[model samples]
Target: MARNDVDLLDLSLDELLTTTRTVRKRLDLTRPVPRALITECLEIAVQAPNGSNQQRWNWHVVDEPDLRAEVAEVYRSGMSGHQADPNRATRDIDYSTEEQQRIASSVAYLRDHLHKVPALLIPTVGGRMDEADIFLQASVWGSILPAVWNFMLALRARGLGSAWTTIHLHKEAEMAELLGIDAAKHTQVGLFPIAYTVGTEFGAGARQDLADLIRWNGAG
Candidate 1:
C-alpha cells in the first residue's frame, strides 16, 4: 500500500525509456524549448549517483543566437577529420544500405543545422583529466555520464529529444575559451543539441543481439 500510495506521472516507463531516440533529422529546429523545461530536466539529472557523492556536474546551456552559432561552428569543424575517410559514415554499421544513407543524410543535416537547434547543452565536470590514469579517468567520467543519461531520459519524458555528441569535445579548449569556461579546471564531456522533437513517436533503433552483448559470468 505504501508503494501504491504514490502516484506516478502519466507516462509509459518502458516506452519512455526505450523510445528516447537519439534525434537528428527529426529534431525540431523551429520550435523553441522553454528554458524552464531544461532547468526541470537538469534538476532530475543531479539526482544521479556520482563518485563519493561529489556531485560535480555543471551544465552549460547555450540558447543565445550568437553563442549557439559559435558553438555550432566549432562542432561542425569536428567533421573535417571524418571527411578524409571516405567510408566514415557507412563503415561497419549494422543498418541496411538505405537506412545507412538515411542516417548519413540525417547526420549531415544535423551537422549543418546544429546552430538552429533551440538549445545547446554542454555537460561538464569540475575536474581535469590530463594526468589521470585510465582507471582514474573512468571514475571521473563515470561520475558525470549517469547524470547526462538522466538528463536525456528526463528530456524524453518531456517530449524533447537530443543527440549524444562528442565530436565538439575534440575542440574543447578552444570552445572553452570562446564560452569563457576555465578549460584548465572543467572538462566538457559532451555537446548535445536539444529541442522539442517534431513528433514524439520514437522507437528503438537497430541494435546488436542481446545474447551477443550479454557476458555470462565473465565469458568475454
Candidate 2:
C-alpha cells in the first residue's frame, strides 16, 4: 500500500477487536507512514469518553530521525535488565512455556529495533497519581486508557500496528526531559511505535477460557 493511501482493512467490529496484535517483528521499517493517517487515527481516538469531559490529554509523536533515535535509546536503556525474560507476572497464567518464549523473543526484537520504527507516540494525561488514592488513580487512568485503546484499534483499521509498551517508563524522567514534557504536571501513559505492518492478516491470540476467567455477579 502507498504511504499516502487511506484504504482501510475490511474488518468487522469483532474481527478488528480480536486481531489487533501487538506488532513487533512485523513492523515495516523501510516504508514511511503518512502523518495524516496518524492524525486520522487520533481523531477516532479522542472520541473515547474522558473524565468530566475535560480532555486534558496530550499525544506526543516523535517522527523526526534524531528525536526518535534518542527516545529509542532511552527505551533500550529502560529495558536493559527487564527484557532478559518474558514478564514473570504472566507466569501464573495458563500460557505454555513455548508461548512465553515466543512472546519474549518478539519483545526482545522490538526492544532492539524500536529506533527504526516509523514513529513513536507517547500519550499523556493531566496530573500525577504517584501517591493518589485508588479512586483517583482509577479515575485518571480510566480517562486516558480508553482513548489509547481506541487509537490502537484505529491503527489496526488503517493497516498500521503498534504495541503498548511501558518499559520506557522506568526512564520516564529522561524521556520527559528529552521530549520537553512537564513531568510534574502530567503522567506519561506508554510508548507506542507506529508503522505499517509487514502483512495485514492477524489472528486472535491465545487466552484462557472466558468461563474460567470471568466471575459472574459476586461469584469468585
TM-score of 1: 0.87
Query: Against the hidden true structure, what lDDT does model 2 obtain?
Result: 0.92
* lDDT against true structure, model 1: 0.85
Per residue, candidate 1 scores C-alpha lDDT tens digits across 107-186 of 88999999999999998998899999999899999999999999998888777889998877767877898888888889
Put down candidate 2 lDDT per residue, 187-212, tens digits, no spaces. 99999999999999999998888888
Give the C-alpha miss distance for residue 125 in model 1, angstroms.
0.9
| RMSD value for candidate 1 | 4.4
Q: How well does candidate 2 score on lDDT at residue 154?
A: 92
Which numbered prediction scores highest in lDDT against the true structure? 2
RMSD of each: 4.4, 2.9
Residue 10 of candidate 2: its Cα lDDT? 93
